[model samples]
Target: MFKLLKYADKYKFYAFLCPVLMIGEVVFELLIPQVMANIVETIRLTDTADAAVQSAAVNDIFLYGGKMLILALCSLFCGSLAARIGSIAGMGFGASLRLGLMEKIQTFSFSNIDRFSTASLITRMTTDVNTVQNTFLMLVRGFFRAPIMLITALVICIRKSPDIAKVFAVALPIIILFLAIFAPIAIKRFRAMLKKFDGFNASIQENFTNIRVVKAFVRTDYEKEKFKKSNDALTAAAIHAEKIMVLGEPALILLMYFTITAIVIIATKSIAEQTLDVGEFTAIFTYAFQILTSFLFTIMILVQVFMAEASAKRIGEVLYETPDIKDPENPEETVSDGSIEFKNVSFSYGKGSDVIKNVSFKINSGEMVGIMGATGSSKSSLVQLIPRLYDATSGEVLVGGKNVKDYSVYGLREAVSMVLQKNVLFSGTIADNLRWGDKNATDEELKNACEIADALSFVESFPDGFNTDLGQGGVNVSGGQKQRLCIARAILKKPKILILDDSTSAVDTATDARIRASLRRLAPNTTKIIIAQRISSVSDCDKIIILDGGSISDIGTHEELLSRSEIYRDIYEAQQKGCDDFDSVGGAS
Candidate 1:
């Protein structure tokens, strides 16, 4: 936890002022009891005296009372100031910690992100960070005030009567032992509680992200049950932790009451024997409360610390996580062209077996290449290598005659624009979402790119045209429309290499053909790589590669593959039969 404090270095002045001012508050508080003792002793001495003596006694009472009031006011002022400073320091630390965590997450490669679940990351950034911030505020204020106040009050009590102070020696150890034994149990429970929180968050996130599927399947009851299970687990864990923490309060209170009773009995005997004065006895009792109350405050602070300990560890994990992929010491600033080569490239998603094994391929600049594979054949994995999303496990992937590792990650990614199979779009107007590819693109550029993707006609048919809003995940658009918009967005990049990973699968055949034609006309020099399930999508490409079981089985033009490659021939025949069946059904209807 202390290691994370470096983020708060900029707020050192406020951090320091908080504790220093708290010490002032404690000093004033300690003086108040002493002043009250003086006032009590003066009154006792003046009892049954002459009128003048009584008058003098009244003046002494006023004097001591005034001193007590001043001390109290000073203490109040100092405490309020300390609280303000502590709040500033604590809030500033949280802001810094959040920024640091977010920046670290942004640097993570795909592999790094896969190591931590999205729900867990969200909990660490929000709930865990909040716990640490609240704990920091408590430490700056109560952590300092308790110990200093305890020591000062203890010293004064011992000075008044050593015998009575010995009672604390007995009570203090019992309190310490109780905390030592139970605090760990509570901390362990808190840790378990945080894990439950992660589960709960995961359940909610999954349900909401797939709400459409859930409702379509009429499985809302199942989702509710899943969420309830997670919610119940979290509640159970929190209750268990709170039960253990609550035990401390009652035990402390019992010990405090017992000690106070002992002190009162002992002080009565001393006063009767003339060994301790009435005024001195009163002050000892006041000091005893102060000391024990400080101890009670300390215990509460320790409880908060234990709660934050789990959060601190979670936050530290994110901050200290190293990205598996990093830029070189001196990286190339530019990719010369879109030419790409994979030399014996193999990759594993951390499993022992490679998903893409001993794969070797080459595509010259300006060539249209198509990748064909069955499900789980690692076709998408192959194209992802071009952008360096995940590094090859064993061999080199080269872009523009240079190893991908030699180029800066940002520069390499900027040069290769990919429309992923998922076709995600942020919540924004059509023009805004397209601008993600090139922020400075003009309205004409957006329209031109949309036209190239065969999206302009539909876009213009809407009353809002390019200004139409796309709700979250483009929920407002049809699947085919979403795919075209994503393609348009990618086209606006004017990248050196363009990859479409089943991006046109949702569109009709004629629309898909028009899109392919537009790409050839508008980006004749850009290297195009297309991955598709339909053989028609890739039959027109300059060359096609077939993957089977993580290895390339054949490579050739469409007609050459139909003659020699069994897999390509089989797929083409199957797609032709499906289209014929669809046409027959339409005619009969």
Candidate 2:
């Protein structure tokens, strides 16, 4: 909690001003009761005096009455100002905390992000940070005022009315005991509730992000049932966590009323016995209310403190986390060329067995290469290491003749463009999405790249052409069109190396052939690596690498692999047989 508080240091001036003004308000508020007492005493005594004496007493009463009004106004002004300043400080701190969290998240490596998961990180940044922010505001607003008012008012009561003071002494300890017992229990419950919140967010995110899949499968009822379970669990946890606060607040309020009842009886008896005056009793009642109300505020502050403590711990975990991947000191700034080599590299996700086991391969600069493997062959894992997305567990991966760790991440990734297996397009116009590759790319460059990707004809057909909006996740376009657009975006980078990881799977074979031919012709100087399931997709590559069970089974040209590698020959024969069957069905139809 203390560690996260440093984000608030930037607003320390506003924080300082808030407490000072609060103190001023408390002081003026305390003085108002004394003036009220003077007015009441003067009015009560005037009844027994002579006419001139009564007239003089009336002036004293007016004087004290004006003083009370002035004191009340001063307190009100100071309180209002304090509230405004406190908001500035609190809101500034919240903004800084969210920004800081985002900045830290951006620095995290892929593995680090996987450790926390996307949904949990979102909960910590939004919900947990909000909890800590609200608590900080409460602390700043009441940290000094509550305790000062409680202590100051209690001392006055003790001096003037020992009986009433004694009642508070007992009541204060009772509230403290209640807090000591219930607070720890509430904190533990709220922490459990936060975990439920993480699960709840994950459920909603998965449901929304994959709504198309859900609808296609006709699983609306099943999804609704799943959501209901998650929602019910969250609600139960929240209710259980809040039970202590709900029950405790009313009990504390009842204590306040009970103390009021006791004081009323005692003060009334004192007045009837001629031991206390009307003026003194009125003043004592007002002071008692202040003292008790401050205690209530104090209790509320303490409750928030306990709850925020849990939130603070979650937030600190992210902020203090060390990224598993980082740039080295004196990092290389240039990639030089597109050549890549993996030297006996082995990698596992965590403590699991190696998915890329002792693999060694190299691709020459500006050469067209292909990787073919069955499902779960760690194909994506192998390519990700080139950009240092995740470092090798054992051996070195060299890019452009320098070890990948030697280059800054930005510098390394800038020279390599990859269109992932899952083609993604944000909600934007066609031109806007394409600009992600090269923000300053000219209109001609966009058209040229789109042409090479076989996307130019469809894009120009849209009513708005380049300005046509893609909608959310490019839902406005077909899967093949989305893949083409993603390919176009990557090509616009004009990178030294470009990787297509099963990116052409959605397109027809004719369109895929056209795209490959265009790439070979237009991007002749650029190194190309294609990972595909279809044998025809990589048949013309300079060399084809086939991965079998996390090892390189064979590396050769299409003709060379057909004669030498049994694994490659089998996969090629299967794909050719499937294609021949598809043609026969078409001929019959």
Candidate 3:
């Protein structure tokens, strides 16, 4: 909980001001009864003393009553101001926390980001943060004020009447007993409930992300069953938590009832025995009500504290997590030469077998090298290492003869641009998406990149041209067009090393050939590493490397591979057979 409280440090002055206002409000509230008691005693005059004496007493009571009313109004005004200040402080705290968490997320390395579930991260940032903020506000207003009010009431009661103080002392022990019996139980149940909530959230996220697959497979019933199971577990857990939390309230109320009854009976006996005055009885009754109000607030504070503790722990986990890929305290500057070397490189996600084992390679400036492999051959994983997305388990990855990890991530990524196979496009205009790679890119620069990627024709056809608004994930465009746009964005970067990882899979063979030709002619000075599945795609490359399983099976030009590499020859032959079969079917039709 202290971890979250640190967010309030910036607004410490406001936090202090809130308590001052609360104490003032409590002080005013406590004075109102004393004023009322004076008015009551003055009005209940016994022998109707001399007319002047009675008149003077009445005037004094009226003066006391006015002072009390004014004090009550002051308290009310202070409370209202406190609420406004507290809310503003809370909003500021929440905004700062949310921004800090988001920045932390952005700084995380790719491997560290992959460790967390997307849905869980979203929930922590939004729902859990909101819960903590709400608890903070409640603590500032109700939690802080309750104890002050209880303490003041206790002091006044002891000073004014010992009998009433004795009753409070007896009641205190009972409430303490209630705490001993239920506080731990409630805490245990609430923790279980929060765990169940995490499971419920994960289930909902899975169902939503896979909704299309579920519908296509006609597994709606199966999904519903899964949802029901999660829902039932959450419901049972929540019920248990609520039951435990509510237990204290009933026990508290019962204690108040019995205490009040005993105090009333004792006061009645004292009055009959000529040991208590009517005014004293009136004052004691008021004190008893104050005690009840104080205890009720205490229990409510306990509940908020319990829930806040749980939320604070979850938020702390994300904020304190150190990314697996750490930057050096003093990172070295990187000079862009576009040379890459992987020296005896080996990597695994964890303790599992290596995904890329004993891989070694060196590419000179402006060389166009291609990596060809079947799925799960670690082609994507290999390129991922070049940008230091994930560190190698052993051995060295170097850029321009310097260890990659020694360079700051920003300096390294600035010189390397990669267009991935997934082809992600954000919701924005064509210009907006292109600007992600080079924020200051002009209209002419964008057009040139689009032209190189063979995307100019379709983009020019759009109603808005460069200003065309792309739907989420570029859903408004065709798959081929999305791939072309991502390619164009990468091209606009004009990076020292350009990586295209199966980026042309969606484009037709003719368009792919056109794009490759355009790049070869225009980007001759850019070091390029192309990963592709089609043999035809990389046939013209200066060199090609074929990965079988996790190790490189062959490395040479197209002609050299066809002559010497069985895996390459077999893949080429299989693809030719597929084409022939397609041509035969078309002829038959």
Candidate 4:
């Protein structure tokens, strides 16, 4: 947690002021006991004395009472200011921490994000940051005030009467012992509780994201059961962690009461023996309470710190993480052409076996190519390399006759537009979503792109035309409309290479064919690579590539592949017979 304090550098002035003002409050509190002692002594001196003496004592009481009032108001003023400053610093630190984490997450590649679950990251950003923020507040407000009050009060008690101060010798050790015994167990339990929190958040996210599927399949009961299990586990873990704090609280409170009772008994004996005066005894009680209360408060703060330590560690892990992919020392600023080649490239998600193994292929500039393979053939993985989304494990992926890594990641991706099978749209107007491909695009450009993707017709059919709002995830639009809009968004980029990864599956064959034909007409100089299950979709391509077991089985025109490649022939024959299951013909790849 201390490591993250760099975020508070911007609020250093407020952080410094919090403890200083808290100490001012402690000073006023400490002085109040002395004023009370003075009032008690004056009363003792005047009891049963002459009227003049009693009158003087009353005056002294009034003077001392006024002083106490002023001191208390000063303390209140300082404390209120300190609290405000502490909150400013703590909340500011949290804001900076969250911003820093988000910025780091943005720089992360797909593989880097894979290392952490989305739910866990969300918990770290929210719950973990809040815990640490609260701890920061405690430290700034009480770090100096508690220790100074405790030590100063104890010293005053000892100097006035050593015997009475001995009561603390018994109390301090017990508090220390309690902290030692409960702290380690509490840390481990809190860590477990945070993990349970992650699971609970994950359950909520998955359930809500796929609520439509659950309702469609009538699996709400199963989802409810799953959610209940997560909720129960979170509750159990929270109780397990809090039980230690609960058990320790009353034990320490009881110890404090016993210690105070012992002090009263000892002070009464001293007064009877004429060694302690009434005023002095009264002062001892005040100082003793301060000492005990400060000590107890310190222990509570320590417990909070221990529990927050778990959250701190989780947050630190992401802040210190290094991305697996990084830009080169000097990278190419632009791609030269639409030409692409893969030279013995292989890739795996992590340390697992390569899903794409030593595969080699090439596509000429301005060529419309189709890639067909059975399920698990790593079709998406192969194209991801071209944009440097995931670096090839071995060999090189070249775009525009240069290694993809030679270009800046942003530069490379800007030139290659890929529409994944599960493309999504944000909650916005139709024009708002299309402008994502080119934010400065004109009204005419949007219509042109949408027309090329066969989306303009339906988009205009709406009452608002291109201004129609698509609900969250484009829920208001049909799946085919979403796909076409995504294609239109890609087309707006006017990228050198366009990849549609089974993106047309939601649209009918006629619509798909229209999209392909429009691409050939409007984007003649651009390289187009299409991945599809239907042979008819790729039958008109300039060349077709067949993938089997992560290796190239054949590369030729559609007619040549049907004659030369047995797998391609099988898939074609299966499709011609109205069969869509490629695995039944092409087998496992």
Candidate 5:
């Protein structure tokens, strides 16, 4: 837990002031008992004195009472200052830690992100960070205050009555032993609770993200049951952890009452025998309460520390995770052209069998190439390597005649614009979302890119046109519209290499053909690689590669593939028959 304190370095001054001010408060608190004792002793001595002596005793009582009041006010002021400083320091530390965690996540490659679940990361950033923040506040305030106050009060009590103070020596160790034995159990339970929290968050994220699918399938009841199971598991874990923590409170209370009873019984005997004065006895009794109370506070703080320890471990895992992909010490700053080559490239998600095995291919700059493959043919995985989203497990992937790893990640990615299979858009105006590809793109540039993607007509028809707000994840738009917008955004980059990974799958065949035609005219020099399931989508390409499983089954033009490749011929025949059937139905109607 202490290893993570480096993030709080900026707030060191505030952290330092908290403990110092708390110590000042403890000093004032220690003096209050002595002042009260002085007032009591004065009253006792003046009980049988002359009138003048009694009058003087009244003055002494007033003097001591005023001193006690002032001490209390000073203590309150110091404590308030400490609490204010502690809050600032603790909150600032949390903010810094969260920012640091987010920054680290941004640097992670796709594989690194895959190592941790989205729900787990969210839990660490929020719940785990909050736990650590509260623990820091307790450390700066109660942790210091309790021990300082306890030691000061204990010393005063011992000075007043040595025999009575002996009770603490025995009681303190017993309390410590009790906490020592139970703390590990609580920590383990808290860790388990955090895991449950991850499960609960995962359920919520999954259900919300796929709400349309759930509703479409009429599986609301099933989703509800799934969520209830996750929620119940979290509740059970929380209760199990709290039950152990709850045990500490009752045990502490019992020990406190027992210690106070022992002190009172012993002090009563001492007072009756005149071995301990009434004034001194009263002071000792107050000190006994103060000492035990501080001990109790310390134990509570320790319990929180144990819980925070679990949080710290979870947070540390993210902060310390190194990205699997990183640029070399001296990387090339420029990409020569869009030419790409994959030589015997093989990759696996983990230690499993290779998804793409010994695959080799090359595409020249300024050429239009099409990739046809079945589901799970590793088409998307193959293109992702060009942007270094995931590095090849074996062999080399070269872009622009240079090994991809040789070029800086940012520079290489800038030259390659890819519209992935999954289209995502942020909550913003249509113009804002388009500007993600080129932040400085002007109105004309945006219009031209949208025109090429065949999205301008629909965008202009909207009431607000380009200024129209796209709700979160572009939920307000149809799937085809979202795909077109993503394509337009990619087009705005005007990259050397443009990859459309089934990006036009949602659009009608005619619209898809129009978009491809616009791309040929507008970006004649840019290398284009289109991955499509529909054979007509790639029939006119300069070259067509048919991927079977993970390997390229055949590579040729449409005419050559139709005569030589069985898989390509079969897919082409199926799509052609479907189109003919649709035409015949239209004629009959």
Candidate 6:
């Protein structure tokens, strides 16, 4: 909880002013009751006075009351100023905290993000931050004011009569006893409520992300049932927490009623004996009620603190998480020779068996290499390390003869551009998407990139051409168009090393051939790596490497591998049959 205080401390000026205003409000509130009591006592004393004398006394009393009223109103105006300051300060604190958390998460390694879900992070940023904000506002208003009011009321009560003051002293111990009994239970219930909230968030996020899957499988009813179960669990936990919190009000009331009754009985007995004045007894009773209510409000604030504390801890856990992949202290930069080398590199996804075992490879500048593999052969995992997405479990990955980890992440990635198999397109125009690769690209450059990726014809056909609006995630575009756009974006980057991870999977054979031919002509200097399942995709590359069981089974030119490698031959035969079937079907007419 104290970790959240750093945000408040950043704008301490506002925090300080907020409480000053709140104290003014408390002062006005304190004076109002005392003034009202004074008026009542004055009337009680002058009950049988002559009309002229009584009129004079009443006018004097009204003047005093009115003075206090005006002062109180002035204090309230100051209090409102304080509240505005606090609210603005609290909002600033929330905004800063959110940005800090997001920046920290961005620096965290991919493995670290995998340890938690996206929904949990979203909850921490939104719901948990709100909890902290509400608590912060309460701190500004209640932290000092509650204690000051209770202490002042206590002093006033004692001044009225030591006998009456003893009543509150006795009640204090009993109230503390009830608080001690119930507070731990309340804290436990609040923690349970947060877990239920996480579960509910996870359920909603998963259903929304996979809504199409649910519909395709005709499982809408099943998904609803799953949602209801999570929702009911959260509801039950909240109700249980509410039940415990509700107990505090009744318990305090029960205690207040009994304490007040005892004081009333004792004071009346004193009145009968002529030991206590009617006015003095009424004043003492008012003071005692004020003290009790102040104590009750203080307890309510304590309960709220407990609830927000749980949320604060959740937010802290994410903010404080250290990235599994750390950058080297002494950095080195790579000059774009477009050379890459893997020396005895071994890696695993945690304790699982080695996904890439003792892999060794070297590529010269401007070489085009193809990595072909069956599923789970570690093709994707191997390339992921070159960008330092994951560190090698052993050995090293080098670019330009320097260890890849020796370079800053920004510098390292700027030289590498990847068009992955799962192509993603953002919500933007075709030109906007292409400019992400080269922000200063001119119209001619964008058109040239589109043509190289064989995307120019389709883009030109759109109503707005390059400026046509692409819907969210490019849902308005076909799979082939999305792939082509991603390729164009990568081409526009003019990276030293370009990677296409089965990027041509969506295009027809003719388009794929044209795109490859364009790349050969336009980016002859760029080092290219192509990963594919189909042999046709990589047959023309400078070198073809076949992966089986997480190790390179064969590495050579297409003709060399086809003639000598059994795995390559089998894959080539399979692709040949697929092409034959397609051609026969087309020629049937």
- Candidate 6 residues 1-589, lDDT tens each? 8787886767789888888887887777767666766777677645755887788668868876797789788777877888898897788788878888899899987678887789999889989989888888887777777778788878977876777778888898999899888988988988898888988999999899778789999999999999999999999999998898788878789999989998998889878887777767776777778788888878878877888998899889988888887767976655456789999999988678899999998888788899998988989888888878788999999987788888877778778888877778889888998999999999999999999998999999988999988977887888888899999999998888888988877676667767878888899988889888767678899998888887888899999998999999988898787753553233211
> Which of 1 and 2 is ahead in TM-score?
1
Clashes by residue pair, model 3: none
Local accuracy of candidate 5 as per-residue lDDT tens digits, 243-272: 987997798789888888889988999989
Candidate 6: segments with Cα more than 4 A from true spot:
50-52, 273-275, 325-327, 350-353, 583-589
Write candidate 1's Cα lDDT for 112-224 as tens digits.
89999999999999999999999998998889899999998998888889989999999899888988888888889988998999999999988999999999999999999
Assess each prediction's global lDDT (C-alpha) against the native: 0.91, 0.90, 0.83, 0.91, 0.90, 0.83
Model 6 TM: 0.94
Q: Write the per-residue lDDT of candidate 3 for residues 258-285, one digit (tens) a residue.
A: 8899889888887888777777778777
In order of appearance, the predictions have TM-scores of 0.97, 0.96, 0.93, 0.97, 0.97, 0.94
Q: Where's the lowest-lDDT run of ten residues in candidate 2?
A: 580-589
lDDT of 1: 0.91
TM-score of 4: 0.97
Query: What residue pairs clash in candidate 2, if any at all?
Result: none
Misplaced by over 4 Å in model 3 are: 46-50, 209-222, 330-334, 579-589
Q: What is the lDDT of residue 108 in candidate 5?
A: 93
Of 1 and 3, the candidate ranking higher by lDDT: 1
RMSD in order of candidates: 2.1, 2.3, 2.8, 3.2, 2.1, 2.6
Candidate closer to the true structure by TM-score (higher is better), 3 or 4? 4
Q: For each predicted model, how many residue pairs clash, with residues at least 3 apart or on different chains? A: 0, 0, 0, 0, 0, 0
Q: What's the lDDT for candidate 5? A: 0.90
Tens digits of per-residue lDDT for model 2 on 1-589?
A: 8788799989999999999999999999998887888888899768975988899899998888888888889999999999999999998999999999999999998898888988889899999989999988988899999999999999998998898788887888987888788778888898889889999999998889999899999999999999999999999999998897798778878888999999999999989988888888888999999999998898778888888888898899999999888889999988899999999999988778899999999998899999998988988888888887788999999989989999988888888899988779999999999999999999999999999999999999999999999898888988889999999999999988899999988787778778999999999878999999888889999999999878888999999999999988888888777864553233210
Lowest lDDT sum, 10 consecutive residues, model 6, at 580-589
